[model samples]
Target chain A: MSLTILGCHSATPRTSAHPTSQYLEINNKRFLIDCGEGTQVQLRKYKIKFSNINHIFISHLHGDHFFGLIGLISTFGLLNRKNDLHIYAPTGLKEIIQLQLKTSNSWPQFDIIYHELKNDQSELIFDDNKVEVYTVPLTHRVYTNGFLFKEKIGERKLNINAIKENPEIEICDYQNLKNGKDFVTKNGTIIENKELTFDPNKPLSYAFCSDTVYKPEIATIIKNVDLLYHESTFLKDRQEIAATTKHSTAEEAGKIAKKANSKQLILGHFSSRYTNLDLFKQEAETVFDNVVLAKEGKIITVDNKTFATELTINQ
Target chain B: MSLTILGCHSATPRTSAHPTSQYLEINNKRFLIDCGEGTQVQLRKYKIKFSNINHIFISHLHGDHFFGLIGLISTFGLLNRKNDLHIYAPTGLKEIIQLQLKTSNSWPQFDIIYHELKNDQSELIFDDNKVEVYTVPLTHRVYTNGFLFKEKIGERKLNINAIKENPEIEICDYQNLKNGKDFVTKNGTIIENKELTFDPNKPLSYAFCSDTVYKPEIATIIKNVDLLYHESTFLKDRQEIAATTKHSTAEEAGKIAKKANSKQLILGHFSSRYTNLDLFKQEAETVFDNVVLAKEGKIITVDNKTFATELTINQ
Candidate 1:
């Protein structure tokens, strides 16, 4: 799985910075989150295939979080998208999108499926063979929820050396061994699955916490994730304002990551008042060791282990 | 009057080019026309005073024409603007905007007045002391209208030398001369206003046409205007495609300007397929003597004459 940062700035769009928008690719499926203004252009700059975006998740209705959504949907109509598009968002998003389409007299030629979120507790939103998505209720000025994408554990790997030594073992027994079951011989002799097979493949997960105040309860829902993306709308100096606005500071985001025991932490949605982002990195690094600032066009891989690299803009 | 090109590209937004959006300042009031995506950022880049914009005119409901409108309005709320905003657009725009606000659970503190355009005939939309705005019925795939902004006639100049030579003229007759009327002195001397004083400053006018086919009837409404901004979405090579889409090519735009006897022509909304805009300028220049490409951030002054200059994009 790879996460692409299309935009990260908070509040408004600037020449050098953008508002919140991101693209995550898991199991070859592209998912867009929090499409702020200019997100469509950012998608083009990052060379993301628009048709590949099958699902979209909106955290809340703040302009910085979902302003570009209507435009992107309109662009899809212009591009003649045919596949069904699924959107998971707050209850009112469907009506908003439909109204724009009606006013423009430019309805999409494809199917648009909307899933409205209402639960205040963690609930499964989507599940496929490879990935499952759950919502984490968050504290904010408005009703908001975070998304947790977890990869399902795969079948165990066979120990070739052990199989070679036990040539008498039936092929069915080997299959059972690969399924993490103990191997049984014809004479009632049994061998532990750990002795015959390697460990099961470890699943990777990523949690996206967008536009929320610092809440310790989130750690329980997103604990021990491979990567965590948290909105850090302000620096440590503006903690008071951050709390008042139901936004998190960089230090607070770092603390969340540390408490969640996440493997890596990516901070984004920076306030426009910040001219220099180095201070955010400095402040976050103090609380968490594996912390990185989310830059536009930056891509991070979430697998058994997490790694990050910058993708060329306009690629 | 000054025109600031916030965005000038056809179709979708890219890293290098933007969709259609422009800011024109006529008299002292700021008017925004056709706010494409990312227009707010462009306004910031150009250092445009967003607060000064009290009026917005949308040509059509196409995404490239007004996708950024909701975002701009939302930003205005975020900035805590108390002044009321006026929008002149097609009938359904109000429903679209209101629906978004309802879904987002965010209502603006200021009033949003809407003037719905339901007639195909040309009608005055805004008439203030200094400027008058009228809609020019247009032919397109969608319900679209062009806008004509004309400065009201100012008080005539005194022509001090001529006035000094005719001191015997009645003081009341001088007021008539200022109104471009013939002056009759109390001593039975008649003087034409043209000879006694310069004619009242000829009001300057600008016509904006976008997403429209080459319709000659528009000349009747926007005849002999000082400047004409016509959409040239394609070059002559793709004239057939342009016609099919109800759009004009550079040559067609120039022809319209030449037929209307416009003093200057500005060609914009170029398709992304053409990277080198020199071809568009060359094509337009072949048909009209004074033709310039509408570049993003270029400011055009339309007074007695039209003058254009490039504004710095990033301050």
Candidate 2:
């Protein structure tokens, strides 16, 4: 799985900063998360294929989280998209989006399905052959929920040398072996599948959290993830303000990352007052060694391991 | 009066091109016209102060023309704006915007008044002390209207030399001269105001037309305006496509300007397919001499006498 950061700023728009939006590629399927304003333009700047975005996950109705959604939907209509598009968002998003279409009298040519999220507890939202998505209830001023995308463990890789040596093994038996199932050979000999094939690679996972306060209880839901993206809207000095506004500071995000035992922590949703993002990384690094600041057009991979790359900003 | 091009492109988002949006400064007051997606960012990029904009005129319900409006209004609420905002648009816009706010559960801190345009005839939408705005009925796939911004004729300028020659006139009498009224002295001497004050400066006007077909009837309402902005969604080669879609080609826009006898013509909203913008200018220049392409961030000034300054595109 690969995660691409379309934008990762907070609050108001600045010359160099953007609001929150991310693109995750898992098993060749693309998922867009939290489309802030100007996200469509950023998508074009990063050369992201718009048609590839089959699903959009909006954490909340905050303007910074999903303001760009309507524009993206409209653009899809203008582009004459034919493929069905799915949106998983808070309950109210459907009414908001549908009203715009109704008033404008310009509905998309494609089918747009909305899966309204109403529960506060963790629940499976989507489960495909390759990935499973669950919600992480978050504390915010408004109804909000973070999403956890976990890749499903696939079949084990067969040892070619071991397989070739067992010529008596039927081709159908190889399927059981690849599935890590013990098999009985034609000679009545028991073959251990573990010995015939290597153990299946560990499934990687990523969790996205934003526009919420620092809640320690979240650790249970996002524990030991490959990558964790947390919103750091303020610095440690503004902890009181963060509490009052239901936001998180850099230090608080780091604490969450530490408690969750995540492999790496990515900090984003910075306050517009912050001119230099180095402070966000520096502050988070104090608590977590593996910390990276989220920048516009940064891509992260989540296959077996997590990695990140910055895309060019010129576009 | 000054016209600022906030965004000008057709259909999808591009790095170098933007959707349709414009800012017009008439009589020193700002008015936004056709706020497309990302318009607020463009407004910031051009250093146009948002606080001055009390009125917004949406040309049509097309997403390209008005998608950014809700976001802009939300941003105003975020910024804690106290000024009332007036929006004049097609009949359904009020409900669409209100529904979005209702679903989001975030009401604007400021009052938002709406004036829905229901008639397909010319009607005065706004009249302030210094300017008057009238809607020009347009032809389009959807309900659309063009706007004519005309600066009210100002007080006549007094020729100081001519005024000094007649010193017997009281300062109060000078007010009548400025109003183009003749003054009679106590000695029964009559002096023509025309000899004292220069002729009232001609009121300059600007007309904005977009997302409309090639309709010659528009020329009647926008006749002899100082500046005219017309959408050119396609080139001459795609004239048939433009007609079928209720859009106009560069040549068609130029013809409208020629027929209206506008002082200057600005052609924009080019289709994304056209990589070279010179084709629009070339096609328009064939019919109108003073033709300019409306690039993002381009600014034009319209004085009471004439329109001037073809601005180079800002980075």
- Identify the candidate with maximal lDDT: 2
TM-score of 2: 0.96
Q: What share of the true interface contacts does each candidate keep?
A: 0.76, 0.64
lDDT of each: 0.86, 0.86
Candidate 2 — which pairs collide? none
Residue B98, candidate 1: Cα error in Å is 1.7
Give per-residue lDDT, candidate 1, residue A280: 89
Model 2 spans with C-alpha error above 4 angstroms:
A170-172, A302-315, B306-309
Q: lDDT tens string, model 2, B1-315?
A: 788898899876666677999998877767999988888889889888889888999999988888888888988988999999999999889987887787777798899999999899999999988899999999988899999999898899888898888878778777878888987768989888888899777888999999899999999999998899999999989989999989999988999999999989999999988889999999999898999889898888765664455574656
TM-score of each: 0.89, 0.96
Residue B201 of candidate 1: its Cα lDDT? 61
Q: What is the DockQ of each candidate?
A: 0.67, 0.68
Worst 10 residues of 1 chain A by lDDT: A306-315
